[model samples]
Target: MAHAPAPKAATAAPVISRMLVHASEFRLNPSRRVVPAGVLIIQVKNIGQDDHDLAVRAANGHILKVTPTLHSGDLGTLRLKLKPGRYWLVCTIPGHEGHGMVRSFTVKKPVKKPARRR
Candidate 1:
């Protein structure tokens, strides 16, 4: 008797990428200003002496993701899948953004690798 051909292994998607952001008195700083479109894990660290929270807003003024309020020395995380476009990181706390706690970033389409020659 002839046996059936073995099944080929399946390919899995890439692992989630990570980004770090620092929240201080009146500023929000990210480790990078540009990233590829995919699953993104944002980690926000409160390095100031007050309460702070982070919000991911789209260019159209819609809020996408947000992290819980973090106290001094506290850490919070926000996980999201972003499309290729412009986004802004801001502190939603009243008066915080007016103090300059906002920054812009860009997400680009991921690069595709050509298939290997058989």
Candidate 2:
């Protein structure tokens, strides 16, 4: 009997942005503030000794996705397929946002390629 072809493994999305939170600090630092419109993967590293999470929201305050709470030294990732626009990233850990744990990001429209002539 002939066997069927094996399935291929899924590929990981490109990590566009990276963030880190230090222990005892009420801040969330992102490596990039701008990204090209498409599948976005934000990798957050919890280098601090505290629990932290990430939230992505639209300009109108509509939440898109939230990652689970990451413990100290834990790595959490947030994946979003977004359009070109402005967005906000906040850490809703009680008073974390109030303590300046929020950041704004923008998704730029993809540039069109030029046409080629024969």
Query: Under the 3 Å rule for N, CA and C atoms, how many clashes does model 1 have?
Result: 0
Model 2 clash pairs?
Answer: 23-48
Candidate with the greatest TM-score versus the true structure = 1
TM, every model: 0.87, 0.77
Per-residue accuracy of model 1 over 1-118 as CA lDDT, tens digit each: 9999999899768646788999999999999998889898999999999999999999999999999899999999999899999999999999999999999989888888888999
Q: Model 2 Cα displacement at 94 (Å)?
A: 0.6
1-118 in candidate 2: lDDT tens per residue?
Answer: 9899899899845435344433235777778788788888887877767788888889999989887997888877887888989998888789888888788988888666678877
Q: Please give the distance, in angstroms, between residue 95's alpha carbon in candidate 1 and its true position after superposition.
A: 0.6
Note the Cα lDDT for every prediction shown: 0.94, 0.77
Clash counts for the predictions, in order:
0, 1
Which residue pairs of candidate 1 clash?
none
